[model samples]
Target: MLRTPAAVRDAGRHTAHNYHPLPVVISSAEGAWVTDVDGRRYLDCLAGYSALNFGHRHPTLIATAHAQLDRLTLTSRAFVHDQFADFCRELAALCGKELVLPMNTGAEAVETGIKVARKWGYQVKGVPAGQATIVVADGNFHGRTTTIVSFSTDADARADFGPYTPGFRVVPYGDLAALAEAVDEHTVAVLLEPVQGEQGVVVPPEGYLPGVRQLCDERNVLFIADEIQSGLGRTGATFACEQDGVVPDVYLLGKALGGGIVPVSAVAADAAVLGVLKPGQHGSTFGGNPLACAVATEVVRLLASGEFQRRSTELGERLHSGLRALIGKGLVAVRGRGLWAGLDIDPALMSGREACERLMERGVLAKDTHGSTIRLAPPLVVTPEEIDHAVAQLAAVLAG
Candidate 1:
């Protein structure tokens, strides 16, 4: 096995310095845990920013990928592969949509949705060309693309990345009056995350999603939910919109759709909205590759099975209750749903990053976001015993 220092040195020599990950160098990972290059194991509470909801190296997803690799891999969009249709059909059913356009990354899915909204605005809604406006929420993290970052509320993501794209209107999140004030005749859509994951797992006020849905319906605007971070059974449901019983016009999905293996993402919507795309409008070479499609098919099957979702719901309750018990002790507050949670630490006591570093030394792995908030989203496959153990470790770290 490679030593941690050697591994870090090798990566630093070859790869771009884009991330500031924790010091631990992961060598291998399995359900709910990762082993570092030094052979020390830690529970992966972060789960790759909710990308590994199925846990690391899930057996079913790995088997599907292997089988598909032995048979076929890529054909490009110029031609269709055998796995594409079934993947699309199942995903469309899962999304309750009439069409699905595959992509390889969450950012690509968001870009696709943006394009679709613009086209629909011009062609179907009869808006002037290139003049459509999409309403977005403040403090939302869609992706790191230039256009996506154009409307970001974070200074770090937007500072040097400009000159940014335009044609977006930003409003305060969870404020119905502000959202209503932002929409006008030229508004094409309202794009937002059901829960702001990167914004310290900030959940919108109750009735926010449903209220937005109603407002969109009344205003003839497309409601586009960026579910890439919060979807695919991450929030104890197949989709976070299910929590509010509201369905968006466009469902942007990614992350767990690849089953913690390859990158598989898509935009799902009814024909009336998604049908705006014609030939030569948009495409990706490896968007619907055979291996990704196969893996994603099994992912959809597992997500629809209700096992993972149920586990997230139950374990989340236990985790939240445990953390709530520690609020005055060290934690400032706890906010989230299902297996996803954000623990705000009292700044006077310790910072979120400090708590996470301490937790890492104690055999738990998590990441902090928005300065003082640590987001914990363990894989849905984690057992009850593991949840208790993680809570105990966190509590001990806080006590220390």
Candidate 2:
């Protein structure tokens, strides 16, 4: 018989101590629920940090993956595959961009965006060679890449990752004045998450995204929206920027793009911006492979139907409303859009880690960030009852 404690301990015995996972030993998952190795069940509220926006092994996505797996999988960028053009065309259409450059991870997409922006800076924007600067926001979580971490304000992510890459500037998020001041002659792009997911699903002030778009246009800089966590129906819209009534010059997308099955990411931009890349400039072998494209193509189809987006909009109201009702009871604050939310548990009562552990014991899985902030991003397939149950579990944890 598989036991939870021994399984959990053995699971971490050989791996790097990078993640501090919960005590639950999940063996299989379907939709919004998972079964532990010991046959215990729990609700998955984190949703793979939005990677499972469509839910675990969604039928269509799984079918597509299986079909593609039986066929071709990879051909590299050297030769075009059957699934390449359709995925790019559909995703570009979804993003309202002229071209899409595929990669295998969100970090790679970020890196690709940086490279493209710099190349566009020199080739089109006429910035001095090797002096192009991309301004980013503080409290941002782009990725763990050294270059992306260079402008990160999080000490844990930024520390010891240097001598950090230069040519990037960090400004306080949601502060248009600071951002405007930071943009100057050599500024190539302003990269930001329309909604900061890792910093506890933090949403900026209203009009902030539009103001950035206007500033980027006025400054001849690219507005790169890193929507890895906020796009593809996670934020009650196709993209979170849409909530603020703005469209960025470039879209850095990943996470949910692969339907939680494979790692897939892409950077979408108009020809004038992305055309700066020549052959042999930047490429990924697994990017746009048949399996990734097949799954992502289904993902695009799913989002195109607008069902998940609508679910996020309608259900998010319920989730947020329930969370707000607990403000004085235990939660200090709640912030997010759609089904994505970050709850700040009253630190005087208990830390976020403790809250998550307690919630875990109650068969609800959640993750905590910073000190007292808990992020809840249940799958879009999660029903109203599941949301209420998760919220009730949270209330119970707080009451105790």
Candidate 3:
């Protein structure tokens, strides 16, 4: 007789069903693999939605975190800690911006970006107070906060989360004309992900980012690129905007910034744009604590080395080619950049949830976003052979 796993059953016994997770309960992880409580091993392809981009327990990140724990952890925003300046300066330089405002989570970073843009519009851009509007892509997945979800096109993330926040205009993601038509004198900023992670790792069409940049520049609107899931080496570049030769006025960053040890998020921009915020107007108690700063500073230095970015670009080609070959046999299409990819399974064969379950049974862990789409974003530390193995396991799952 087969018994249901205790970890799977107990996981939902007292918790909310916000996430329909796979039945595997991870007990330990290293590089790109995790071990279940029962001692079974599985290759992790989701990489915590890119939060573990450097892989689990990276040596530098862990060491820094440990040292900080021994020294200091939190001091609040009242009195600055020793590790704060270095983190802010280094991360700002990483984004090539002059200033940075650290926060705690990806959603806080998005909300901070929205607040800064509106304030900048009223104070710097000469827009009328309380009339500023920000444009967002139709299929964006910035975060689940009430204000952030107000503009989301995904019904599941937005439904029942209202009366939603106002002043956001939604436009088709890849349509420049629609975006341009949506913006006007009252527009303050345009927030978007260069690669929409939750919307199945959807990469916009070529020239779409450049067009957005041009539109924002022509209309004097700040361009805020939400790089929470697409930045910090996941997209083969320090920032995904570099892929299109576009530099946004503000960069919303998080996910891997904390090295998967703590939650660290930030908004970066030149002084003129972010200077609109007066002291006490916006701050987080734990935004740049000693521990978060220590860990995140090392993360910035790691990205500065560009090794992870190189690995993502080199390994991504191999991964994508293999996935494309399975199109007619099972997959319908694949789209993404760098180490990120969205695989569309033939719904006739199996839904994404079923495919993921079958893959988990074969020792490969992945995630489903939409009905038939699966997102693959293995950590940059993953090896070429491991990538091949994951692809093979996926193919076998489809075959069955």
Highest TM-score model number: 2
lDDT of 2 at 312: 100
lDDT of 3: 0.93
TM-score of 1: 0.98
Question: Pick by lDDT: which candidate is best?
Answer: 2
TM-score of each: 0.98, 0.99, 0.98
- Per-residue lDDT of 98-189 in model 2, one digit per residue for the tens? 99999999999999999999999999999989999999999999999998888889999889879999999999999999999999999999
- By lDDT, the candidates rank as 2, 3, 1
- The TM-score obtained by model 2 is 0.99
lDDT for 89 (candidate 2): 99
lDDT of 2 at 61: 93
Q: List the residue pairs that clash in candidate 3.
A: none
Worst 10 residues of 2 by lDDT: 1-10
Question: What is the lDDT of every predicted structure here?
Answer: 0.92, 0.95, 0.93
Two-way lDDT contest, 2 vs 3, winner: 2
